[model samples]
Target chain A: MDRLLFGDNQFFGVNHMSEEKARAQSMKFQDLSAVIDVLDAAYDEGIHTFMCTTHDRVGEIVDYMRTKPERYAEQIFYPGMPYAHKYANAMTEDGMVGAIKRFLPDGGLLDAAFKGGMSVAKKDIEGITTLLIDAEMKMFQGLPTPVIFLQNVVVDLLLGLGFKDAFRIFAEHVRKKYNAEPGFISMNLPTLLKVLKEVGVENPVVCSNINKVGFRMSGGGVTAYEKALNEYEFQAIAMSVFASGAIPPREAIEWVCKLPNLKSIVFGASSRSNIHSTKVLVDEYWVG
Target chain B: MIRIGMVGLGKMGLSHYSMVNAHPDVEVVAVCDSSAYLLGLLNRYTGVETFNDMSKMLAQSNLDAVIISTPSVLHAQMVKTALEAGVNVFCEKPFSLNPSTSRDLTELARSKKLVTQVGYHYRFVGAFKEVKRLLDSGAIGKVSHILAEAYGPVVLKPKGSTWRSKKSEGGGSLYDYAAHPIDLVNWYLGVPSEVRGTILGQVFSRETDDEVFSTMVWPDETTAQLSVSWSDPSQRKMSTKITVFGSNGRITADRQECQTFLTDATAAPEGYVEGWNVRYTTDLTDEVYFYVRGEEYSAQLDAFVKRIESGEIEGQNSFGSATGADEVLAMMVADANRDYAGIAAGPAPQVDRGLFRRRTKS
Candidate 1:
């Protein structure tokens, strides 16, 4: 019997700078060789596939990955995106720091600084869109990258736009400019599938949570959130297997086993022990 | 307290570093490896001092013991060096590539009366501990037969002409991989009175077979089937498992994960032991007395320190802890060789996977 499809989900948020810096710093002692060694160990441990979110770093590795496709070909999965850029220089350091501080509880000066920092991050997302979009087009043509987008329930009240209003703009941009099919843009609600159904997402439809679902925390563990059984008619994804460390492997496997509607379950192992445990679950549940 | 030094800063060495350093009353202060790269890795990750030379590291560390986690071929030399330094030692599995070197290492440990331990972490897993406990308690009366299965993906990829790929360096799957379960079987049940197995290199392009299957017959007429493989595709990992068949009951242990469940048929409701309902109740985790038996790696180190302090290591086989591991590897290697030869000569090892299959119709 074929095992259930399993892949990891990794997307970059605005914390990209810090993450790159960390990797770059580590590369002083352990360069791409170090990363490759770890990746090889993972592959040897049976993690045959890795899903990299659309980001500049991912683009670099994907290019590296293409060169050694035999070693990495079956292993890397690319998810495309409509890049959102944020401008960092436009905001002063003190202004950014002040906003971050304001967002903090009790609104102290330090907390206001934290809020300011986050506002800059928000602004940065908007600024990166053009660069991200250009990279997305190049990636689609050159590689197996699948486009990914995001959908929220309501239109922008500030802009007085409906849901379709924003989507239509992006769709037109993709079609006229890139001349490529728009792939999956995850939606906040399954009901939004109605709008996407009209547009026809060529890529697979993935279902995640607007917030945490399931037990202890909302929409987290499978014990609490049953699969969206009523919405089973749509091709769906089961993401966030290890949303909380509290859900034991046995519980997760049992839940996934019961979900007949899911095309696949997405998860990953970050350590050797985790790989061992996940193998046990995969052998027991998916392989049977 | 046993003051110990460790060699090799690889994954296994790091594991030893953590285990030894974490032990109370033990000091793991000195580490060594020829690979400056690996030494830097261990130093950065473990914060232990490193030496490029094992001899210097041993002599200068002022330690009572050493753990050799270097390559397999280096195990014998390292163990001998530590023993000569009047240091008790703990060496990792595949004690040696061949029986002669293993025997020599064992003899040295015995003669020195040094506190030696072989790194066979599987023996400490709670699953087998429960199996031992249940059998001792007569929950599974008179263990008459046993079967062990081991397989993983490590064997399929060539160690690529490294020392691990050389027979002299213990490159074969049987030596490097099967040693764990083989040692476990030998520990749980005495050596097989008659051993035969089939080894297959059916996957990897190597001088040795990457997969193996064997059967052993105990003197008491009990039988065991041992299946070991390194050709699993998804991951180079394994689930070392065993099933003990006894007069009163049967137990299944997925030992690698430290999980086991058992059932006694003779003690069953209708004297029917073959079903799920007959499972004898016990917490497998609790049954493994590592926290009490003082058999944990740390506890083993503490014991060596005690021996050093008491001057009582004489006649004790310390570094020969791989005694069980070596024997298992030897047996698996022997069996695999015979199995492989037989296959190449047009006969295959006869196996019946269904023998253990439950009689569901009844």
Candidate 2:
């Protein structure tokens, strides 16, 4: 696993804690060129993995990167699937299948299956799930996507709804079709880890909020997270390491280093200085 | 374990469903929604139970409590029905479309001593809570004026209108979005006694106002400038902020952090200097056992469940306080609907509009 992963939240105006900062970022990154410049900056800083939600703008980033392979030879994209807003707009006009059909790489088979039999409708979930994954993966066709994630919104929802098998389905399908590791992004790590272990996905890769203060950590907060990280046999990728800029960088990084079994830290930086500084912080503090 | 039934499967409904379903002390026995697909999907996945109608779910589910996350139009009816069924209710914001109905529901809940709550989740937010604490603790003395503002990207262009754009349903930006900031103001400072110069301005939606601006006047002459806009693309999502100016110092807070300026060292709280002090939401917030979108979401649900178990009819976001917010909203509605000439808008005892203060020759 990459020790330093770049995230797209800053470009997408998704500061979890501060609206003012989010608005400022939205204004700063309205142009695609600004986004590309930052990505190039991160790449120069030796952070190659870009973990991003499959927002429409990401397609443009993928296309831009595809044009110059040599320039971004080592750069990798970790795509998170099922951007809800992308589906929402289309769902309002056409039904779910119609929305899926618009994005499905090979809609003909799914369309015929839906028309030919009612069986898929009854258990349309797995069928639709694979199709949506294909649809989202289409944008990253030739790119190296080593890991793919189910967004926390859907993963947490599925977790709450008690469909433990969905994790297995997501894992198996991703492994079989995309040749990538299936990762789950959730707010509740302990509960999700238990479910993944039950579903037989050993050493699963889980990304969540890992910080000193219990900002968004759920399922028994900081102490429970400490217990899980120490005991569980899983790769933990810490996001929101600074708790959305609430905690100072040195303090946040120092605290996160104390946790056991941490595989990586993903963060978003809008400037070259920020990227450089964060990389330095991680290197300086992660000696343990 | 508390046997709870969920109604509605919209965006908020789905979130509430997840939190409640995962809660250890609660069992989501049945769900109700108008969407066949959502209901079918939940039934297939969880196999709890599903209903297309609220009354049917209330009758058959044998629920200890029902969480109503439907549109504002349905809250009054569903809350009334749930109360009559002898189950606690957690209704979404803008408790009722009409102020009178808000009053009646509060009265009915009080009479039955049923645990009731409104979904003003902002009350559970840490930064906003700190704002309330600072005010209640007399850290900021004799607040004279306040500026409450909310902006969001709900309506960026003149496009299709959802239920939120329909004024008749009390689903306009005023009720759906602006009510959040207004609730914050009401929570910090009591509900204003007078609403003046209320302007329900429209920027995008033709069916309803996309922006709401009003001046809220308290009984003691403290005033707040309420400004809100849902047609702002600059904001990625809904951002509510408040700025208060008092005799001693000033205070400003949003969902993320609270900043305070103290003129004198005497007014400063512990670990705070007299100049400027900031408390981030991360430090201010407490951990929730089941975290979703935000801890506040789970915290509110936790509070509601605890109240129900403790048999406390009044707690955070009680129907009584919600009614206060609704009364202020009703005042804004009336002020916006009324056509005002300059003379008539003049404060009593009716000053003539033509009179002007003498000005020096420029």
Cα error, candidate 1, residue B141 (Å): 2.7
lDDT of 1 at B165: 51
After superposition, the stretches of candidate 2 with alpha carbons farther than 4 Å from their true spots are: A84-122, A246-248, A284-288, B342-362
Residue pairs with backbone atoms closer than 3 Å in model 2 (clashes): none
lDDT of 2 at A82: 78
Query: Could you give the fnat of all candidates in order?
Result: 0.00, 0.40
Interface RMSD of each: 23.4, 3.8
lDDT (10s digit) by residue, model 2, range A106-195? 777666556543233534667867877887888899789989999897888778878777888789889999899999899999999998
| Docking class of predicted structure 1 | incorrect
